[model samples]
Target: MGIFEFVANNIYYTVPIPVYVAVLVVLLCQVFRRIFISRRPSIMESTPLAHKTSDLSHYILKSDSCPALQVTPDTTYSWRDKPQEVPREIKPGKYFLTMNIRKLDPNDYIIFDERFLSEYRERQAIIENVGPGKIFVADPSDGGALDLCEETLVVTVDFLVTRYPSMFRKTERGVFCIDAGEEYDLVTRPWSRHPLEITCLLSGEDHILIRCCDDGTLRVAAVGLVYSLNIDWRSFIGKELGSIHKDAHVPFYESALQKSVDRYFQKLPPDKLISRANWLTQVGPELRNDNFPDKYLELVSTLPGNTITPETIVNDLYIRVERQAMRKLPSTNGVVFKFRVYATNIWDLEQEEGIPRRFADHIRGLPEPILRQKHCLECADCILKAMDFMAEQQEKEKFMNSYD
Candidate 1:
């Protein structure tokens, strides 16, 4: 008999009616169960900053290595414990134009130090001297920028007050800063100022760069650069990420680094926060530097290779480091970029363990192009020689102390 005829005969003669009915009932029950589950609330989708957030694709889809990334809430920062002293993260490796990023806990997002009061005053004075338009600014036309800034400001206030209750408190009169002696009635007071400016006054960090994604492009929507850090942030507002880097004259960004950064921004999830540090050698004053690159080049050119010595290295040259963090905003689907700038003596940098050799190596590793931009070409030899002198002095002291 043919295959079709044999199967037809088996369906009628071999199979029982109860067996067909049971199979049909089982299939119908599975369909109804799935429909009920689809209507139910999911624990994973409930919270943005949950231990784990998953979509239906997580169950239905499978990747080659399905490793799950998780972030644990830090209890120490939440409880407002004093943070320990951290050594300068400045090192030899990852000094080049690269995104050296790592996980950042939400609790320890904003940093406060002994210099908070001074920094706050300095920034406010800057605002007074120069208008808020030149410092803390937002794009007037971009509605998304305002919403993103306001939402971020709200988050910042709650985060700071919760993390450091002793410093930031909520009294009968709205939020208060103990050190600054400032109070704001968030409810009744007319908010004449921009949301980013308000955020600048409340936090120890003066520089806040906000980039919001619009139509697949991430652009600088608002900037709270209260302190003068060379380039004016007002001009930076509304420029896309690519233009910002190009305007800042970040070396190799357009050529080698833009695509990588774009990919990183694309993959950044709302629940994750990442931090990185970048360093540059600066000559003269660390603050109020307008057209820093041209000025840096001019200053370096005047001091020829012959004039640099160990005595004047720290006095003339400074190692300026910036610790930056990129945080994903769940509410607005935006990214808030924050950076804290610190200038340390090059002498102090060499004093750190293994830094002398590592620092020397780092300078030599860079190509001729960046070396010229960073002014490493002008000072690298002198800096290395001075580091050697420091190293020799340390060895001599150690040998002398052996008798003791």
Candidate 2:
């Protein structure tokens, strides 16, 4: 009352006493909330740095009964959370024409989702059948490659434990994977295999470790890239960025992206974790298709019954998105291009809330180079017609609901 009386008398602009009291109450409530509430850190704040794994050779064991361990990025994901992130990344009315790189949340550096067990088995089968040498290629000449392999092992194990505590318990014996039903003593390799090979089986995710050359170009020193985007991983093992992109048939690298990418790598600090997403369409449902130029040619075939019409495009077309994150290793001075592939049928696009029309528009808006890069040029007409039809139906439904 005294405070209100003082304010009322002192201020030239007279405010009501109740208004003053209400403002005071709101300010007090905000103060209390700030004192009690726990908030996520602001963007400018540093991500919680991962703790290095201790020897743990004789550390006291924590009980696994009720999950004494905790997990972060605790937003639960499942098979239903199909990773066709195109719809989410596409702004409400915005479309991207080029690489839309963004700062990645460190917690989201690796996503161990519902597909863990299935993908683990699938990647393992590839190893047993196709041979590990084909998938996990390492440079015997580069010492940094071995350093990257070891440090990657440590980082991956630490991540699995920290991000998924209950499932991956780190102890004296190494990591105990609940889903894999076995323990991996990768802490001290048994001399049977390399650390990169062990990490290949650790999760479904893949990586290519990049080492900087004295000439300021990034070189692919090693890779455990199994889920193929039609690139021959073997050919890329020793290639520099230019040669790799030339083999990749990567569009606009020399003209548009090479200089910027080179500069980014040189300027990148070990402390920054960044990510970007890229996507394209394929003819088949396979997630690991290494068949390249031929696959693009197959889409344009005019052969009887083989040509994809608007109707058949739904079942035959598959969309694959690679969500990639990169971090420059402080210890190894190598950059880890960590990524995972998520594939879905074209039918899934129509079912997504903001996909059909927006995606169709995005396709229509794509420049020729991007269209060729995405392999959408040959089938663009059929894809646009089909999605535009769906968009029309959606509009009709909205029109019909206006009376209600």
| Best model number under TM-score | 2
Error of 1 at 272 (Å): 1.7
In candidate 1, which residue ranges exceed 4 Å CA deviation? 1-87, 91-97, 188-190, 212-214, 290-314, 395-404
Q: Candidate 2, which segments miss by more than 4 Å at Cα? A: 1-88, 91-98, 188-190, 229-231, 291-314, 399-403
Best by lDDT: 2
Model 2 C-alpha lDDT per residue in residues 288-373, reported as the tens digit of each score: 87432235457446576675454455557777788888878755567888778887677767667657787787787777776777
- Pairs clashing in candidate 2? none
Residue 170, candidate 2: Cα error in Å is: 0.7
For each candidate in the order shown, give its overall lDDT on alpha carbons: 0.63, 0.67
**Weakest ten-residue segment in model 2 by summed lDDT:** 40-49
TM-score of each: 0.71, 0.74
Write down the TM-score for model 2: 0.74
> What lDDT would candidate 2 get against the real structure?
0.67
Clashing pairs in 1: none
